[model samples]
Target: MFYDHADQQAEAMHPNPDWTTTPITPELIRGALDLETTQHGVLPHRLPARARAQCTDPQLAMVESQPSGVRLLFRTRATTVELDTLPTKRTYQGAPPRPDGVYDLLVDGRLTGQATVTGGNTVTIDMTTGTAEHQPGPPGTLSFTDLPDGIKDIEIWLPHNETTELIALRTDAPVAPMTDRGRKVWLHHGSSISHGSDAASPTNTWPALAAALGGVELINLGLAGSALLDPFTARAIRDTPADLISLKLGINLVNLDLMRLRAFTPAVHGFLDTIREGHPTTPLLVVSPILCPIHEDTPGPGAFDFSALAVGALRFRATGDPAERATGKLTLGVIREELSRIVRQRSADDPHLHYLDGRDLYGERDFAELPLPDELHPDAATHRRIGERFAELAFTTGGPFTGHNA
Candidate 1:
């Protein structure tokens, strides 16, 4: 997959590799396990006996399974490693504690072991008593005591949980070669709204959910408080190879008040131009932001929300002319119109370029039905709604996002 000049440079600098054929030597296997332990912050959930057996060509597979449906995988060899799971932080008002569940591990297609994550870790602060107390509970760990030699495959199974998440998978060994499977690649960039700010599960983030719904591999470049039209980011997009691509714009710029209308329009143009340099005909969808009342028509001073201060939570906000905003001066709606117009003009020569109103994903009607908790980021339910809408609008049959065909 060849991209434009910027993309070619990025590919050369950080080439994506195939990891399937990479031989899993003992050293490599140990390195993989160590990497997983360190980067993933948790041990591999399960490992079958065959995973411990020595083999010339070792591989790990994860097939959907149930009870809890937690899958597991293991590297061929093992070494002493410590794994830990981080607790989830409550980022929203009335957010509930995350649930915990069990995950199983399989080696070479057979169940080898399992570990339980008991979710009851509560440290209550009693203002009346002026004391903080810890509730003791069973800790979570998976240690394989005995094993046969010649291991080859590993898998992991995680039941539903609230407190812990499978943020990443890591291996100390070099990445294996790319598998010979056709996996759709998704490239997306956006604001903190896309960064899983108020989402419930790690996998429940809108982009993650949309990927699952569309069955595509994802490269999320969603940065918190930083989707402000950086040329480097556009260059990054230009350099990456993707079967499909989307850019969620507008709200971040309006909320940040990063640039005036004069600058915003040209920046948007330049951003799209840079991406086109690499992906001239890729199915590219540019989306505006969801409805945000405060910053809808107003510019922002980029201040943090003090409302949560009463509850001891810090939230970011964009400040601007409320009166002018009320008169419909500066809003995501305004930007959406401009962006659509730009796409329409540019698409005359670039038919592959497309535009979608953010309202299509979440409109004023929906906002009235399910309002955002912090006036900015959506709740978990809203994330699910947005993901489903995106998948339906962009990935379903006859949808706007036909990927390679588009």
Candidate 2:
């Protein structure tokens, strides 16, 4: 007997007949701006479909689907829960094999369980040529049994780095959207650091940790390698419902060597302008890049450290000349200076606008103590440090997110 695709998928999801299977729906998800229906299941997207349609770059497409801060939010009395997912795992030709992405399950705001899905699709990337080939695989299930008995809020945080297509949610009891707890909503946008590169788990990402500490609901638009101050991204921020907002700028612009200092200033202005169109008086904070020694003075087009690559390790170094800054070449120093000036100028007429030095989150002192492992992304310990520092700086009494600005 032959089975169709849907039948096979259904069979794969329902291996244990006793559990009540529930279709994953919009209300059950948070942090994702949109969801795309696929043959296997529903894929969450950080950016809306309209924004995605505007660009065909594969990097942007892949990062948005990775669901950096996305999670399933519900309240249930279930003692056991299982979710079927199709994850697209990535691997570079020469580097060490990447670990399976983790799913963090939170019970009533506390981390109670964690699991990783296996046997999903894989994408092999050629680091030298920047080409990628996809190979399909089977779906996998993440099961968490022996949850607490009482009715409690449940949050299953999707992997911060993997492209996960959620297929089904099964539990011993019924579930419903978790009731609001009166927390402020924080919507943040930034580069890979904010996307949780090297973070231990989804809930351990800096934004996630900071949100937890700040007592706010989080909506992370932290697109890896794609926070290029694009108009559509700004529009997405403009349209998203956020009580507090932040934009972490500079790193991606400098590293991609995407523009000159001349183009960079106006791009920052236009991006802020678009956000203010909808969020006219919302508390908006502009954050500059963290201290990256290599790119601090040197212009980029950051390149992989071929020496490290030869030993099967991953590392990056700035490739552009420091002298090129004379011809308007962009560097971290250039971007940070420009961002500070822009925010200061904009804040004159907009009291709600604020500025933050990203170094305050992860500074030179912190770097000396816990340097970036890849010279690009923060490690798990650094993520925790940044999260703690962010909460202290931005969510505390005198911080921008604490009170309304006149």
Candidate 3:
């Protein structure tokens, strides 16, 4: 069935015998943590090989491969471009099919075209049943033609929330890797907020928006629902090439109740320790959780608010009792306090390190006007707000991320 469908599409592409088919290698893509070659094409893993081996959590594996902030950055003189991809589209049983992942094409840092790939595959996930079924289909090609071409920097941004397997790239003219424009690479790690959970598109994610505003390259490590302070993630941060780095912590820990303050305190220390190992003097900012009213005082292990779901909508509520906070259990309010303390204490010895209360990005008053739609993740407008705030706070002169006096 796969071959049968693929052959039909191939015939269309073959009609233009002069089209150049180029192989996609690591050089062609940016923001992907790892690349694995497959018979169909290349599978880009946002987590590196070593990191992948350490954790066997299916959730982590799935989210990282979504390629939210990853883009195929290149320079080409072509007037037309075609990309083949096999995307694993998700369905929630009774829920309506999520919109197809969007491919955003940018020329010279400006939006030029948008596309969506058909065919490919589908993975239906039944949360109620706790099972998933994969149905394979042939790769589909997305074509964009007619452009004012005279050497342009092109960025093909992958879908924000879909697992995509890139198969091939074709163009009317030759393509080459885009030359490094001397932009500082900002490596960021955070929760679903940074992952673009409800973002309009991949390029609209907070990190991506901030990167655009700050004139920096983004390597997003914002894994959805899997930002548990894993040792492997810390090591990846330590090893990655980055001029500026930020770690957004706390929300995932509180929502999952993965550990108590006792374990969390040391885990935060250990995570920073590992990162400091590689870039001892890098500008590393430890950011606390953003303002989430649900988990502000109450502890969590957030649960789906079934009442809201019954009306064909998804909503979440903090399930952990507020009384649990009397013990070592964690909450956003508590985590913010601890993170600020830890950074203040650490910055005295390590000047390059900094502390940023995530509330500074999106706090109480702002929540009244721009509420988090899901009571958890920020909406598109909030991402823009956070991105603008981050650029003003971190990239401005005299900021921690900007060059400062020792």
Candidate 4:
């Protein structure tokens, strides 16, 4: 994914736009819970108010602002559209350079094109050196032209993994906020797997995929390395308007080794309680972590396999001791049991609460065919599998997320 930095910089520095620029407003954005106006441009935040205030951990701050499921939605008659943005690209010192974040264009709900903006900003992390550096680059423009003529709904899904600072939007035809298309809002919260970690594009993320299949508007709170049943995140989810809600729990807890089984239980319960406060009857589905054989029985603090990194690759291995489980440490297996029990106990009174074992989406046999490339996150194909599976299991009739699809 190495780019010709010199060539990209030259293009970024130049100013040539045939289309008229339009000021983007809040109404045109979707999937972002909150947005902050910055000197560079608008910075989208998946977490809002109290949730943001509670996030002091650098990893949480960094990933939540990456705009994983965020997209710009508007109506336009334009034959051409261009978006200028300053995107922060990550480069691991030892691993093969990652690809430039991808921008996907959808006209009237069908993907029409894709492009990558080059050379906006850079963040280099050296695990060996235990240091990170930020090298800022000029803003780059992603242009799509010669679209079908006539009034059309245009959605430009931002890169799910990049910290994109949107500078401006230009279109040949005047643009307006998308009309209320009357879609059920679906708010989904989960770990990096749900954040589209290795998915090829923003729209291809499982949640994005499932949402399209189920015909729901999505507000994805899939924060990488941060879905640890945080109270504020619960509150943020509680406050957001959603007809259907889902909380994908487990992996991040084990990976970070954040709590023992004793504490994890109450945290899950409490997290649900907060969300129930706002939408008591919302069909809330509790999804356990998808099967990661490595963390199924083993506890984590998952660590980057340094040996693999040395060979110019990236791979992860769970480092926590299995014996630690005896001390109430969390594991995917334990979390599933507890999450199911908790949901069952609550469902008697709160019929809206339901449970879905993640293994159903990616169990042992499925893993054999579609193993996690990083030994944790799913690859693009796996994302598609999980997304389709979710749509089948949760978005189908008789499923927790099904009734609200209308």
Leading candidate by lDDT: 2
For candidate 2, the per-residue lDDT at 354 reads: 92
Q: Scored by CA lDDT, what does every candidate get? A: 0.56, 0.90, 0.86, 0.88
- After superposing candidate 3 on the true structure, give the runs of residues whose Cα lies further than 4 Å from its correct spot: 1-15, 404-406
| Over 4 Å off, model 2 | 1-12, 15-18, 404-406
RMSD in angstroms between candidate 4 and the native structure over all alpha carbons: 2.4
lDDT of 2 by residue, 28-131 (tens): 99999999999988999999999999999999999999988999999999887878899999999899899999899889999988888777899999989999
Q: Between prediction 2 and prediction 3, which has the larger TM-score?
A: 2
Per-candidate TM equals 0.61, 0.96, 0.95, 0.96
**Positional deviation of residue 315's Cα in model 1 after best superposition, in angstroms:** 5.2
Tell me the tens digit of each residue's lDDT in model 3 across 185-223: 899999999988888888888899888888888999999
User: Clashing residue pairs, candidate 3?
Assistant: none
For candidate 1, give the lDDT: 0.56
Q: On residues 119-185, what C-alpha lDDT tens digit does candidate 1 reach at each position?
A: 3244443333434455543233333324344435554444322233333332323333223236677
Q: Which wins on TM-score, candidate 1 or candidate 3?
A: 3
Report the C-alpha displacement of residue 297, candidate 1, in angstroms. 1.7
